[model samples]
Target: MVSFTASAQYGKQKKADTLFNKFSFVKAAEVYKELIENKYNEDYAVRRLADCYALLRDVKNAAKYYKKAVKQDNVPIEYYYNYAQALRGVEDYKGSREWMRRYKDSGGVTSTKNFGKDGNFITSIFNAKQQYFLSKVNFNSKLSDFGAYEHNGKVYFASTRDEGVSVKRLYGWNEQPFLDVYVTEKGSKDPVDHKAKLKGDVNSIYHDGPVAITKDGTTMYFTRNDFFKNVQEKDKKGINNIKIYRATLKDSVWTDVEDLPINNSEYTTQHPALSSDGKKLYFASDRPGGFGGSDIYAVDINEDGSLGTPENLGDVINTPGAEGMPFINNEGTLFFSSDGHVGLGMLDIFATVADKDNKIIDVINLGVPVNSSKDDFSFFMGEDGLTGYIASNRSGGMGDDDIYAYNRVPLLNVEGVVTDAINKKPIANAIITLLDGNNRQIAYMETDEEGYYEINIDRDVDYNITASQKKYEDDSESFTTKNIETKVTTITKNLELNPVQDVVILAELNTIYFDFDKHNIRPDAALELDKIVNLMLNEYPGMVIRIESHTDSRGDLTYNDKLSIDRANSTYEYLISKGIDPARITEHQGFGERRLTNGCDGSVNCEESNHQLNRRTEFIVIKMK
Candidate 1:
């Protein structure tokens, strides 16, 4: 019975590892979780489960499981590095730093390719400048909708929505219907109502679509499974690898389909993109002799319609991880999605910066809203360059992968001043944070000497801003830019922070009094004075105060003046004896028979309780650093 149980466990583990190697993380994670639930090799299952979550960019769950994996015996040192990165993604900087130190101590080789210089890199990236505004397209359904392309006067994309087929077909990877090419008019009043499957022989029973077209719309290149002529071809493992195919349009119907020369039966070559002049074709492939799992390659389109040999984009454009979904804009810039770059999520979209000789110079991440903590790919830009679309599987989407429209507009300058509520004085060195509608931090900075901050933000967004400083209550406010309409708009949002009251006032202490003309610290008076000493010594060590004593109207003016001075000295000495710094008491003085709280002057008869209020000592707060 025990031998049979071990065999069953081995079978499940083999299946999960196979899926993971094939880059099907969503399906692999399900099997790994089931193994963990059944207690089948729980330690190995825990490590793989953590890795799956990390690859999925689900940092919250990844961190949770990694915390458990690191506590297990004989764990790999690489898991230490991954756990630190996952913690950093979830904004746990302190924990991440500690685990990173442990990873280094355990002889793990460190590299900053994925995580930059230090632990502070996450904050630096999160506070990047806003360059685009993203909103979900209205036509997205509760299925896999992505790979949006625009040509002529319509938009085409790949989707798994129902198409009324007599028999429902589903893909084993995600349990969704096979992808099909769909189209809708660009400026339709109701795009969902006008949506329909493309009119052509392009789509197949298997996966199809996400096509690229030429300037004259005479040619189209699309991705499809390794199936043609009603027969599917598979690799040795029985997996149908995707391939890029070229189709020509004749009389408004797509026909004459032929596979590209770059495709191989043993590997996958998909995601076709065309240059503006139609003289070059770019695509992603997992062919041999590449830098990573898949690399971006380009081929020359000769005048006679023959293709040249494929050339890899080089190591600078690829990493040990996957890089796919190539898109070239009208200005000859290449945009691609990658998982091996220093980014905010698993798959982030990046743009290439090429030199004068057309050699790639740099790769810049297309920062937030466009690249989220999930798989974001298939970036397409219109000819105007100001409008584009991106697909993401991040939270708050209507489908597995939803399309989001993006617009590039001039940045809005948001300037603000932070001041004290009581004195209206500018508060320098105050921390300011700007957050999006979901309370995710967008930018952060410290106030300048003038208590001023200026941040450039995207238009048509709601922000929650806050200011904080030592010994002051935090101030927060919300602002929106939906009403703004201009090339350059400056929003002035001022904040007022209230100072925390002194410890004595907050403690609500009773009056500290002495015997008539004795000028000695009484037992009752010492108890109240101890409260001030404890607060200053332990809580507010930087507190600076001044001591003042006042006398009643019953004594002679000259003697009462002498008595009040002694009383102030006694209170100051008592606080110093209790371990409070003597320098904290800025000054000690007395005013005799003056500044009475009640109308108990020499001419008026007053009760003893009224006069008691006059003979009191006061602790006035001068500064709290």
Candidate 2:
């Protein structure tokens, strides 16, 4: 909990202020720390110390001082937001939310307020599949090696790595050697010797490079400080604003270097990215009428190699905090770094999702491992989208900023066929349900006529695949994918469902009997007949049945035949009335006393139960599929 101050009344305070205003954050931080130690203007020095760490992407120290700065009276409202972001960098999300609440209460427009409406957002981000496996590239140095882009099988990047010389000039902001564009053999084994300066005049003595190249590899767009023709230009604050420049490749070397018309001495416009079709150029700028310290803008690349007016991407992509370092992939997805969005910390990379009309509709955070608490920017994806590179200033890197190669685990490609177990025949229109280990449904589809199904699923997850069809038993199989190694893997999983057991097996019904010498259905008999009607309507819609009625041996043959026929007709009418289609009842007949259950055909003594069975109607399943 340290504190400091700066006041115009002191000479040392004025010198620190001059350096701070010039963007010399590192040297300015040193002076601010000394002032705080000496107790000279403690209030202003404390807040400025936090600002220095924040700008340097040193989240831990930034959070430490910002905590103290926010407690002081008359603190600016934006300090609350900076403190909140610093808290997020340290993974203190609860503390971040509190400070963000205060910032919003004080009339600050922030993404935190928008994120608060969805309680599961943070959990969803963390719980999402970890699709990428990242490894540090070999050529990273102990300086700032970052901004990797690939073109024509060669990798190009911007780095402050020393070129085997002493007495090199350093940028005052970071006290590092000025950045220069460099090239290396793609996937080179000799990281030291294969790395060399780019084959072009684009690299300047001042900060240069981190470039974008068109698909044809004939043109390049790059960023550089406003220094040209052996002269450096400065704006009102004595700072050289950055600008974008275009260059052409010819005769195996880049030439025809020229500054783009979008450059303005009063503001910064840098970090160029060309669209896949080479018709649009996207870049970051802090020119007038921007929403924040910086915002992303786009300009049309005309047919004659000229440029059109710049268009701001609008408030959806820009916020009150800085947004910059845009990269557009071949699929037209815009990946950019932003500190304004609610994220894990200070500059997280977000990819835009656009509609079919090519208008950006949503932005998605590329959660952890790719993004860290420190600044992560400069994302480039290959055509397959699974292989890519990103730059991060987080710890365990070879430098202040290092490039990491990443491979996204491709979705598991699956196709299968479902069939009837007994006949080995395809089962059409069968429902296939896919569930996770938690039994939550992930996806579902109906099998085609060929009983074939195809779907893609996430890797390294447990799943249950189920197949179900009418008149068949449900079949399910458990599948688990673990540690699969491939760019894209295809698997086949076949399922066989057994047809339901015979319909007669469900015929264990109560004895459906008629009264002695009666041709009508009794109230008790109707209840039993309803069971047959229900089974036909619900379980087996295609079942065809026949009704048979018999009489006890106590009746005469002629009388029994007439009574049995009437009883059979009564059962048929009842089934039809219950919505069982008449077409499904193939026949109705009277068996009289011919089909006796026992020796109760007027020739032997039998119990009353035996007689009741002989006086019953029967539902025979003629056909079932």
Candidate 3:
């Protein structure tokens, strides 16, 4: 091996390679940039600089350097991948896929369909309906600012604002001041003027910020540079990695700053987001055995206040690229930023919907205004869940990275429990549906074991929440979210469905009146039969019913039998036409005036009312499944 230790240029080259290997892209780019500006290592420096920008999702800069970074032969396959992604970020689809194809041919995945020109990635996200209306916050400065959170009546964020004495000491990487923790009163008309940096204990001379507060607001776990207590330690490359620190609030003062157990100096561990119960702390780390350069991890916040071993989120959420900046909303959604996922070619925000048991139900990207073809990260939402802030280096920002506030029109959700009216006990497995003002079904879901169901509704619309179950009468309630003016964000509705009647015999049926021995069903008869039809179809969706028709003894037995059969067939056909499944009809037959009530079997004269009773048609539950 040649010894290049005597050369200054070789020493810098080795340092840049070390930084890049450790995933310190921001500083690695700076080191590579110096090598290129001085012409010390133009060929190697240009390619490595572009690689650093690509990994950090600075796509525009990555593309710029990538134009000059190509080598004729023996180039690493990842260079093709980075150039392809950077090209896509600038909307140059044709150029992107050319390099993407090269990546596929060079020991990458054989299928280039995902990043190809014909890919549906952009079209899918662009065609989606906008979920939120974003407004750039007023407090963004001409430096990097991001990761805003709310507690009590104040908003806390990480910013490179000039208030900190460390502001004068710019970082060697981005040329911005070291990140410091800052706070301001929430919902202020001009929060920038009120923004103040945290005290010495919290905001140190090095990078500090992006904190996670507990539910009670008494404790917080934050991220800061590993230079604490004047004991600055570095790796083989002499670069100090990040660490997670815990601080407690006492009498409105944050103190007792201490290092968390999960921190590792060999790698970066930062971006702490505490669970709603403060029992688990979710964070982003570059630790080994991860699916990506960085992956979101979670550790138990033990009952005694010590930390447990970190667990990776899993393969579903982490890819082989960088993923960081994790935040868990009050409802247990894990929101994080990732360049690994298929998005608009930059860092895009995504979320994992979780149930109370912490099982992930779905993963979704927060598309469009919340995501652009630029580096967007550090997403945070407020207590209301509608108002929030994000960080982006997208076009027309006030700084290298600017903070943007997004206020979504509260997605009006209505949820409740279904229970028994008599015993007031939960009704599980009940089918619940929601309808709009026009009576169109908007959504439907089944009640869980605890009889809980939730659904979102459109704003300024009236809704009818209905619950149904076998052997139960359907119950419904009407609610309107129109003109609420944010006074009511969610509606709680409980439904108590009543049980249907146990059974009905033939005598209970309405009169089967016909005009002068005619067998056709009259309008009055149709109305009467409808009640039975509803009972069979709705009350017992799986039950089959037998339809029986009777006739008066005034006609011959053969003719009467034929006429009675006609009446039964006509009634059965009507039920079928009304959406009652034909397979649900067990029998449709006529008795032909046999065994008539009141002994009116043609041997004696009977009153009209008594004859009407004999002419009646009825049903009996024959089968159930």
TM-score of 2: 0.73
Residues 184-282 of candidate 3 have per-residue lDDT tens digits of 877776545223876537778789989888888788888999977768777666678999998888878788899888987888999999777779999
Candidate 1, residues 1-625, lDDT tens digits: the string is 9999889988999999998776577788899998998899888988888888887667788988899999999998878877876775675767777887798789875434544545554566678777779987877888888899999988889988865555768876666788988888886656452137777778888999789999999999999999887789988887799999888999888888887788888999999999999999999999999877789999999998889999999877887668999999988999999866666666789999899998887788887878876688999999877788899988899967899988876468789899877456688899999998989998899899999999887778899899998768889999998778654568888998876665655454455887766778888899899888876765555567889998999989988888889889888888888887778798989888887888998789998888878888888877642
Q: Looking at candidate 2, what is the lDDT of residue 394? A: 89
lDDT of 1: 0.82
Better of 1 and 3 by TM-score: 3
Candidate closest to the true structure, highest lDDT: 2
In the range 211-322, model 2's lDDT, one tens digit per residue, is 9999888999999999766678888877899999888999978778887899988899999998889999999999999988899999999999899999999877887888
Off by over 4 Å in 3: 1-42, 52-58, 68-71, 93-98, 109-118, 163-167, 189-195, 354-358, 410-625
Clashing pairs in 3: none
lDDT of each: 0.82, 0.84, 0.78
TM-score for all models, in order of appearance: 0.61, 0.73, 0.68
Of candidates 3 and 1, the better by lDDT: 1
TM-score of 3: 0.68
